[model samples]
Target: MTTKPYFLLCFVVGLSNPVDAMYYVQPWMLAVIIPLAGIREGQQLLHELYLLKKKSYAHINYHIGMFGSSALLAFALEFSEFLLVSSTSSLTLSVSGIFKEVVMLYLAVEYNNNQLNTLNIVGLVICLTGIIFHCILKFHALQKEKPVNTDLVVTERLLLRRMESADEWSVDGDSNTRRTSLDD
Candidate 1:
């Protein structure tokens, strides 16, 4: 619920993934990384495209609504991915996903007042089937993977997975909290 707990889960999940290693960048690097990520989010490019569309199309309000919805969708996707990765179990992620789909469907019907015809019903069925298959595959894959050894040195190494980019030295703190940087 709190960031402290989420961060602790992040550390655990990061170490648990065998295929992908999660690296914690130095705290000082946040200054540059955060701004760089913000700049690269394509807001300016999206704005320019929207302006071009507005000039070419007669329905300016339509363009505005589309762009606004797109921005909201992007934000939603980013936040959902962050939560999904931070969550401890597949069940939590699956439930949250189902809740999201249900909310979206409700909003669509409420806003448009469109009837769910046979085609729409088929689409919904297919989508639900895909979601079920995805969950099953994910759980199966997780079960097949070898469990990681969460030793003091191993976790410390995992935490500082990509420490070569940072110019710092590993200091002795607690065994679990150690970090190895390029200097070491």
Candidate 2:
């Protein structure tokens, strides 16, 4: 049977904003979800390993070290992604991911002597334009929502304003604020 339909369903589910928000609210769900996913993936890995007829382990220690490093890196990557999603919206993460891919594509073209046709260039330009627009819209929205501290003293050299504590800044669903002082 074809797996396209299942892949499409998963893609649609992944793009659901409500589901993403729900996951954000209940991040503990990862404890359950990740294990289930790992089990499924581990089964697939075992099947593939079994299919291999000749498997030689000359440098078992080196392979074990590499596997350990790979696991650590994967954990670090997931942790960083969780923190990024917490600090910014999922849309921001998606846009940044696409931009990263575009950069990688360009780097490959430059360093690996990969050729890009007109269509590839056009696609890259469109992706870049969309990312730029998204960034501009997000910046303007943030600027409009940001509370300006009216308590200001205009000096000759510097424009100073009262620094609000993290608690005050984090009100009204703004969890992006970080504690700046020990007093906070």
Candidate 3:
């Protein structure tokens, strides 16, 4: 299956977990994990390591696939959490959920297609269970956290300017209408 969405989900969720706190995760993590995964994936495809036999390779795939899956799951959970913190649900959550679920299901189907070992199957199940709890807890916590209304002053200034502009425009328009009526 196409792995793009899965990776994107993981990237977003992982990033969300911290960014909402105003503490950014180092971009270096992306700078590192992605290239590393790509390199390893390439190595696995091009040259078979003697140490990883046929069975061992399956384990490798399972482990890597599981990690990727977790990343996707975490990304989704983080997004939901971000929404929860906002204390209101809207179109945003719905769309995000749909995207996350579709990719998750796609990866799951691909993982199953590979004739995974029992260990891999078990790992997937366990990880899925953990993800469920993670989403629930994170979202709950987000709802509890208060959003920073730090921009109130700036917002007030902008609103005041807009209101003054609107008043000026309306006064001009009204005066023009009055002048036209008098002439008539």
Candidate 4:
């Protein structure tokens, strides 16, 4: 049997995979889709930072060039599921509840601070509630007809917003690498 430390590491790593997968999918989607969703740039940027001067055209243009991971993840999920049609999870969905709660705390605080309009607020609530229900009631549960990338993209987009907001709210960290603050 593996040692306790190894098992603990495995558990922590497993709990973190969803967040990484979700984040890995976000930036690329932001670089591509969210910008083209036909909303004002400043408007969307505000969702990330609570309130910032609207992103300049140049800023948005720069973000468009950063779509690598999102593209790869979507492609992999598609090709693997449809073309290969043989690969499987090989692991149970029994992620730790504590990890889920930690993630939920970040999500809740970000949502509370976001300045979404009435329509967006309504839609976001519906989507978030659906996600919670889906995760709790069913983990591997998926609609066979819809591509999994749809969910990945959505989660990633959300992950970006939450990360951006949290990074902005926190002191002494860059949003990119997410370096944490330290006290002497």
Predicted model with the maximum lDDT: 1
Runs of candidate 4 exceeding 4 Å displacement = 1-115, 139-184
Clashes of 2: 0
Q: What is the clash tally of candidate 1?
A: 0
Off by over 4 Å in 2: 1-51, 58-74, 88-99, 110-114, 147-184
Against the true structure, candidate 2 reaches a TM-score of: 0.39
Looking at model 4, how many pairs of residues clash?
Answer: 1
Clash totals for all candidate models: 0, 0, 1, 1
Local distance difference test values of all predictions, in order: 0.64, 0.60, 0.57, 0.49
**Model 1 weakest lDDT span, ten residues long:** 17-26
Candidate 3 clashing pairs? 13-75
**lDDT tens digits by residue: candidate 1, 100-139:** 7888888888997867889988999898888988888878
Q: Estimate, for each residue in 61-153, the C-alpha lDDT of model 2 and write its tens digit.
A: 675798899778666655555556644555566677776687789789999999999998898889888877887787778678865653222
Better of 2 and 4 by TM-score: 2
Per residue, candidate 4 scores C-alpha lDDT tens digits across 34-121 of 5576465766666745433565455544455555665676666543332221122312222333344446656766976745478966
In model 2, the Cα lDDT at residue 118 comes to 98
- State the lDDT of candidate 3 residue by residue for 1-184, as single tens digits: 2223333343444432335432343365577787778877976655545546556566677768987998787776775555453443433454455566557667767976645578976886786666666667767776898977654335555767888666544234436332343453
Among these predictions, the greatest TM-score belongs to 1
Estimate candidate 2's alpha-carbon lDDT, on a 0 to 1 scale: 0.60
